[model samples]
Target chain A: MIDEKELVIALKSQNECERAFQILVNLYKERLYWHIRKIVLNHEDTDDILQNTFIKIYKNIHKFEEKSKLYTWMYRIATNESITFLNKKAKKKNITIEEVKNQLIENLESDIYFEGNQIQILFQKAINTLPQKQQLVFNMKYFEDHTYENLSEILETSVGGLKSSYHIAVKKITAYIKLNETI
Target chain B: MKRRENIDKFKVPTNYFDEFENHLLNKINEEVLPKNIGFKTPTGYFNKLDFNIKRKNNSRLKEGKLIPVVSKKTFMYAASIAAMVLLVFSVLKDATRVYTLEEIEISSIENFINEGNIQLKQHEISILFTDEILNNITSNQSRLSGNQLENYLLENINDLNALLPY
Candidate 1:
């Protein structure tokens, strides 16, 4: 595997950028797709956001200053794109962003792409109750297994703040699941 | 942490991610994206970096110029055209409809009027008396039908009294 330095250098190079980009896509596509899918809850939407994320990365490669790791920068872009996609959907439907999230949860039962069983559905509903930022923190920390330090860098939050948000999110999810669980 | 919490609840189709990159590449541009790449980075990678940068730019992925058939604007245009077509068809259907006195049994007309389905606006009833129609009524001085007294009196009382001159 090419190290970060070589990847950056190659991505910046006009001649070798495409090959470097392909490598980048191969490495990160699934990770980013899942990241987006958890928020959007729609396979087609995740696919769309994933495509846009890569395209945005390709377009802006020359402008990347490398102050942050490329993956971190890409994650931030993907998160923003997912939020933007949600906001646009809300506007189109004349619903609040919260309502859009609720609608997505409702759609999950009927969505052919959703394979989650009842517990997972309840898990999603619990996650949906958190503030969007906390939801991001929890998903990254819990599912992606991102360390506080890594998530701090990727999310541009202090490690302490990320921890607090994740802790709160976990507690809320637990309470919600227990409150609604069937015997 | 519970053991169950560690297990993944969400699932995707088999090989969904493994098949993703190549399919994505094909969707973007089948011909442009490089398929075969075996990475073996030897020592002195930094030394060859400048040589690699100076090589041909032909490997660069050209932005895929999407050929559009039915985009948002196209769909919107189609919807508006469909709406307009429906509007025109309804209007034309209404305009071309006619009811001749000979085709109707009087009782059906009476039933329609009694049911309030045949109700006409006052202004619409006024339009039934063109100047030619009034002159024909006065010239022939014939059958008066369908609230004809109010219609003729409203329009032609002076003409009637002048013709009687009594």
Candidate 2:
């Protein structure tokens, strides 16, 4: 693993950028890809957003102020790019974001990327019913096990705010599953 | 309790990350290498772009060249107006020129008086015919003879007291 500060210094330096960036991509691609896949729910879409996220990070690395860890900044970019991609897909289909989510849920069975059992499918449906922010809060905490403090830095929100959103998200998901689960 | 069985539902093919870099590098090279960009440009836009930009810049440089030529023509018009004003002023001055008295001639007075209207009173005529000319006439014996004088005296004997106060 590359030292965070050293990677940042090389990323900011013009001479060593190509090699440093390649390293950066190699290191974070899996973690970032899973994080995006959780939101977008398909491999191809995740791959698409992941590519955009790294390109965005490479382009804006000079403006990285070293205020946060490099991965956290990359997470922030990945989060934004995924949201933007979903919104674009929603617009292209002339549907609201909620309608788009429902459509994605309907198409999950046929999607080669998704191989979840019935419970997992219900889990995805319950998660999709959430507001966009609550969905993010739940996914990062539940799957990635991201701490509230770290989530705060990546999301630029207060830790207390993140906890409140996370708890609310959990309650909603549990309630949605209890209400809708067939067996 | 059921939610606690947090088996991560998503999966990737084995060694996906191990192979991801090369694919990503290929994608990145296709995107970032400039020559193999993933985006498509309009047809022939590059072929025409250089010619178009240079034509516009050359037009702009040509536009910059136009200003001084117009100023030169304006300067020429001003100079011609000044010359015309000076020529008219010199011609008018010569037309009004004043000559010295030495340069002028006084013609014959008799010819001038004869040509012009002149009148004289009897007293003015007496001044012109002076007493000396009268005396010269009276003293000449050839002009009045003694016998003619005696005869003129006898003829004017009754008017002698009025004619000669003595």
Candidate 3:
């Protein structure tokens, strides 16, 4: 992997900028794609959002202030795009956010991506039970193990507040899994 | 801002069974690997764009030779239109009403005094005129009282002398 700072320097150079952006796209495409997929729960939707994220990053790279890492900025864009996609989908389908999430969970149970995976399938259901904010925080922290500082930068939130959010998310998911197993 | 030094205590590890971890790791590995941009884009694609750029550049170089002939006729047409516009404006300039300084000042004052009914409140006008009259009357009354008080004191001076002779 190219050093991030070096990649940024290349992005600022007159001729190497496009090449640097291509490198960035190759670097983050998969992780970002799955992150968005987990939110939207569809491979095709993930593909669309992933492409759009890269395109937006390319167009707005000049506006990036470098106060945060490039990864954090890209993650923020992916999160917003995924959330926006889900919101628009919910509106168009005339469904509540809760109903949409429950439907996604049901679909995830039978999803090709969830094939032959009992624990991951259950865990995804548990995550679906969480509120939207908690679900996002839980997915990043629990699965991706992204640091609270990086999450804070992407979310524009305080690390202390995020820690609480993660804590609540974990508590809720644990309760959900236990309750589901009992039933 | 509280220092989040030991927030890992909040992380209750879900039973990430070995199979689950394997599945997750496989997904991560698949996702993090660099995509082959040229894998599907095929070779010689960029070369096509370069060829197009060169062709356009050559065309532009040829167009540079034809500018002088085109510019002379464009400039003549532009100048003729500009002259016609200036002549029309000059002919109409006298018909446009031109107010003198005194006329402009008087009209502006009248306009200011009668700006609009929206701003001209009856109570506000009455209060303003009342304030001016009251101020004038108050000053005059004070002067008249001062003169009367002086006359009364002077007329009573002989009576005081008769009552208390030295």
Clashing pairs in 1: none
lDDT per residue as tens, model 2, B1-166: 5565655666797778875765454444323111210112235633543344345445655876755655877899999999999999988786767977566555554555568556657688778777999678778956788867855654454222123211
Candidate that would win on DockQ? 3
Residue range A1-183, candidate 1, lDDT tens digits = 679889989999989987888778778876887788888887767766777677667767777778888888888888878987776677578677789988888888877766567677777878889998998997887667788888998777997688567666777776777788754
Per-prediction DockQ comes to: 0.01, 0.00, 0.01
Instruction: Tell me how large the interface RMSD of candidate 1 is.
Output: 27.3
What TM-score against the true fold does each predicted structure earn?
0.53, 0.52, 0.53
lDDT of 3 at B64: 61
Question: Per-residue lDDT for B1-166 in model 1, tens only?
Answer: 5767767666887877975764454344323212211112235633443333333122333334555778989899999999999999888786767979999998998898889987788888778899898788787766667667644553444222123211
Q: Which candidate is the best by lDDT?
A: 1
Tell me the spans in candidate 2 whose CA falls farther than 4 Å from its real position: B1-166
TM-score result, candidate 1: 0.53
Q: Write the per-residue lDDT of candidate 3 for residues B57-82, one digit (tens) a residue.
A: 45645876764655887899999999
What would the per-residue lDDT of candidate 3 be over residues A1-183, giving only the tens digit for each residue?
579889888887789976787677667766786688778876656766776677666656777768888898788888877876676567668787678877876676556544434445566677777888888887787667799888888777898788777766666666666676657
